[model samples]
Every structure is written in structure tokens, then in C-alpha cells.
Target: MADLDPTATFKEFDADGDGYITREEFTAAMKARGEEVTPAELDSIFRVADGRDGDADGRISQAEFLVAWDR
Candidate 1:
């Protein structure tokens, strides 16, 4: 797959314009992209994203989202 633009993708997923992607926003984004993420998969994604969360907030920041996307 072609590399996605992190900034653009991040903005799109940040539905609330809060500069962070909550789990709900992430799930909605995934669904919009036709990705049916299972609960297990969502948990895994959150775990990975949280691991990279510098501020320890539950939501994923742009930097954290970019890191996960690059991976």
C-alpha cells in the first residue's frame, strides 16, 4: 500500500477537532474505511497506541498516531 499522509490522516480521524483521537473516533474512522475491527483488534490497537503515548492520555495524539501508522 502507498504511504498515507500522517497529518491528513490524523486530521481526518480526529473528528472532534480536539487534536487527539479518542477510541471512538478511531473506531469510526476504521469503520469509515471499511475496516471492521474486532474488539480484540481494537484492544490491541489501543494497547500499541498507548504504549507510544508520551502524555499517558487515553487518546492518541498526532505524534502517537503517526508512529502507529508508520509501523
Candidate 2:
């Protein structure tokens, strides 16, 4: 996982190739990997990831994702 390129990985989750990753996109991406993630789990994750700025727009930008990934 650490070896994976962040930009490419982020793009994968972006799904629609949007500049940001929405909850739906993230969940879909996780499912594609055969991981079953619940809404609560996703909520917890976004809470932490988006908490970085205290203003989460319900979408994750590449820069925000990188910060979360490093942690």
C-alpha cells in the first residue's frame, strides 16, 4: 500500500474523475477491492480526514487525501 502512487490511487477512488472524492465514490472504490465498508465506518473515516480543516464539504480533495494517507 505504501508503494502505491498517491495520485493514481486517488484517481481510482475519484471514480468520475472529479477533482474530489465523494462518500459514494469512496465506498464504491472500497467495494471494488472486495472490502465491505459500512456507512458508519465511512463516516468515521471522513470525520477524521475532513476534520483536518474543520470544514468538510463531503468531498475529499487530493491534497486532503494525501494528508490522511500519510497518517
Candidate 3:
């Protein structure tokens, strides 16, 4: 598989163009990209992503996304 561009991937998942991704947006994007995640796994993903949510909001900002992507 080709290397994925983190910025591009993050933007695509930010469906609302608000510069942040909610749980719903993340799930939809992952599913559309052919990823099948269980509810427990999804929760874990959210936890990791939201850990970078500086404002404690339920959304992942571009910066946070980049950090997660790099990891």
C-alpha cells in the first residue's frame, strides 16, 4: 500500500470542514475507507484521540490529529 498523507486524510475525515473531527465523523470516515472497527475498539480510538483534545472538547483538532498520526 502507498504511504498515506496524514494531512489529507485528516481533512477528508473532517467532513464539516470545521477543522475538528468528532466521533461520528471519525467512524464514518474509517468505515468509508473500509475499516471495520468494533464498538470497544472505536471507544479506544476516541480515548487516544481525545487525549490530545487540549480544550477537553469531544473533537480532535488538526494539531491533535497530526500528533496522533505521527504516533
Which is the leading candidate under TM-score?
2
TM of each candidate vs. truth = 0.82, 0.87, 0.80
Taking every candidate in turn, the Cα RMSD to the unseen true structure, in Å, is 2.0, 1.5, 2.0
Instruction: Give per-residue lDDT, candidate 2, residue 27.
Output: 87
Q: Kindly list the per-residue Cα lDDT of model 2 for residues 1-71, writing each as its tens digit.
A: 34378888899899998788899999898888888888898898888767876777778888889987888
lDDT of 2 at 21: 88
lDDT of each: 0.80, 0.84, 0.80
The C-alpha stretches of model 3 lying farther than 4 A from their native spots are 1-3
Question: Cα deviation in Å at residue 39, candidate 2?
Answer: 1.3
Candidate 1 residues 19-48, lDDT tens each? 998889988988888777788887787777
Q: How well does model 2 score by local distance difference test?
A: 0.84
Ten residues in sequence with the least summed lDDT for candidate 2: 1-10
